[model samples]
Target: MALSSTQTDHLRRVDAIGDPPARPTLVPAERYHSPAFAQLEVERMWPRVWQVACTVDHVAEPGDYFEYRCGPYSVLIVHGDDGVLRAFQNACRHRGNALCTGAGSSLRELKCGYHGWTWDLAGALKRIPNRKGFGTVHMSEFPLAPVQVDTWERLVFVNLDTSAMPLADYLEAVPTDIAWCGLGDFRCYATMTIAVDANWKTIADGYSETYHVQTLHPELHRCMDDVYAPQMIWGHTGKSESLYGVPSPRLSGALSDEEVWDAYVYTQGPLMGVAEGTPFPRDQQGAGQSVADVIAAQIKQFAAGRGVDIDWATTDQVMRLHQYNVFPNMTFLASADHLTVMTSLPGPDPDRGELVMTLMTRMPAQAPRTRPADVHMSAADAHPGVVMSQDIAVLTGLQRGMHQPGFTHLVLSSEERRIINMHRNLERYLDLPEAERISEAAAGG
Candidate 1:
């Protein structure tokens, strides 16, 4: 689809934001605390973009369903008896009462609390409590409004606009890139959601850089590498992949040949050596050599090769933390053995929002291969109530601080530029005149 003249102008405006400067800073007050900006975002951005709902794991069986909120809008995902997953506005057509309450479940019909109006799983109005007073009422035209719903891998997604472009087009190359990370096979071992005092962007920005690992998480620093670099893949739907290469142990400290060999054998066993079929040496690191020492040596070698100076002793790499901010409102984190998906929903109060995190994995019975108990991984935790507490503290604080007169803009590093890019994309969507920015992109746009 050819871009409308208005959309073309919008794109030009985005390009004018410039290739992004070296030190782009955002005004904390405008973005974090301004109620005006939040309302504008809800109007311009929330409805037009694709947002994650949940995963197939949560509603795998027919009649299974889940409910999600986007701004003031409530949505229900229903798996009909015919095995099709559909989304509907959680409201009745008669008096605009909420239709389905709580999370969705197997049911012959959904009855409203305010009035006895009922809808079938397919969203068709099946009954009205009193037919006598509504002699001329047309139920056919009053069926629930439908929303766009689709799936990628096993995750469910919904868009408020019924005419929006197909989900596949919006996703672009992201699916293939995630496959490269072996995400399709990853099982959810644990999941967490914490309320933050800062904006949703703040939560995302915090995870984008490893600059905080050394200071914020001293214990994790001791076990991981210090150099955290992210590679950006740009498009309508983009991705940023961060790589943390494990350092070899021999370089960290002076070690006897026996101890060095043993250290290499033990630490590398699960990661590099096992795939190579190397035997585990008896004395992996010398009696005097610590895991930290081996890691330091590995880091030095890598930095030397890249002409960069960073410490491995103070870095963390085993968890291979990855945050995939899928455009609009969904972000996924992939650890070495688990995956967590976080979805942001707009709130009635612009300052407050709802976030849902879902963890998924293959059932043990469904797996063809069997591993020993020591090697077996556990399921991911989906309840993020605790982790969210820590996030809420910082986010709320930041949001409040944005109200200060001294706060103006945020300075960002080249490494942290992705956050700015995200904001730019958001601006592009939100700035479009109400009519020009349609719900779905045309086929070829």
Candidate 2:
């Protein structure tokens, strides 16, 4: 017999509470300075989560390999002789030295630099410098430790737990959402790495909102439509984000003289357009109109040739940036034309963190694509790694400020609540009894 409507509603409500809709602010100290908390997080929260390591393009050939970190653990991604992608603990069994220090082409065996103990791509022990030194020793028992590895949409991920849930199960709605954004068809364009003196959460918190756009990036802010607000997505393993809409000045037909001036200023400012002479002044009449009005004007003018009345400023097309924070340490941001993945891992110092950004594009078949010589900046300059460096500075400063004797709690904006929800999920996962925490599926139907 089928269940009644009331029963369905009850089940839905129960699920919502299990993954609560609202949560309290995460105390600054809990995240920024606590070693005990960080360790517990690694053991409980990170091990069960899905983390992005690298792209399939990095190791496309049979022998290609890449190395990445899952929280504090270093993992090696290898394409074995059997033509399978595998992930293993990068540490060697003999003297605890890292097996692979960097990324490169395929290797038949990964040999330890410290002691020369060797293991194949499949992580099976193949060679020992002196087998007879240890009498009656079993080589099979010394194979490298394996980690749970999987791929989706050509991205690689590793989980420390041997029996962790499948990547799809943990990802929940992210795959379908990414498909909606047309990310599968998009390729990487550039990549950069920034080492920062702050907690990983600090870097993530900065990306979660558009509130900083107006002040933090005054020059770039002119091109952005500020009227539309951001929309948040709830109820998944971690924090998932989607923008409802953004202002598009080019689509809006109401651009005033002042709006045009702002656009010219933005275009001329070190990045986009570069033409000589002072920019035109804002039209006095256009100065009073909303930013949306000016954007509408520009969009109409630009679209008239294409035969469309669409106002990109008021339209949803402007809301193209989609970001997914895949619990604990990775954030994936995508737009119609570009994609960037940021991985945040804990550093040796409690007050510092390391971030690696991998930017990619569709692999072209023959002719190599190169940045235009006339362009003032490289791809990295276009999408300045300095922006992340700025964030790192702020996060580290915030980390230090949290320890002040006068500081006690935090005041959070509605938009900043996502960080709070992230902490709550961490707590829920960490607090679960060992048996109950095994797998979401095991919690029962």
Model 1, residue 21: C-alpha shift (Å):
4.3
Model 2 off-target regions past 4 Å? Answer: 1-28, 70-72, 225-227, 234-319, 362-393, 432-445
Residue 331 local lDDT, model 1: 70
Q: Which candidate has the highest lDDT of all?
A: 2
Clashes of 2: 24
Per-residue alpha-carbon lDDT of candidate 1 for residues 151-268, written as tens digits (9 for 90 to 100)? 8876778888888888888887777665644455544433334443356565655555555544554333333343433445464554443323222121223333344334334433
The stretch of ten residues in a row with the least summed lDDT in candidate 2 is: 371-380
Can you write out model 2's per-residue Cα lDDT over 269-378, one digit (the tens) per residue? 22212233444423622534433233334434444443433332332232234577666666777643336777776766556676667664333234243321111222
Over 4 Å off in model 1, which ranges?
1-23, 181-192, 226-228, 243-321, 347-350, 362-393, 432-445
What lDDT is obtained when candidate 2 is compared to the true structure? 0.58
**Model 1: lDDT to the true structure:** 0.56
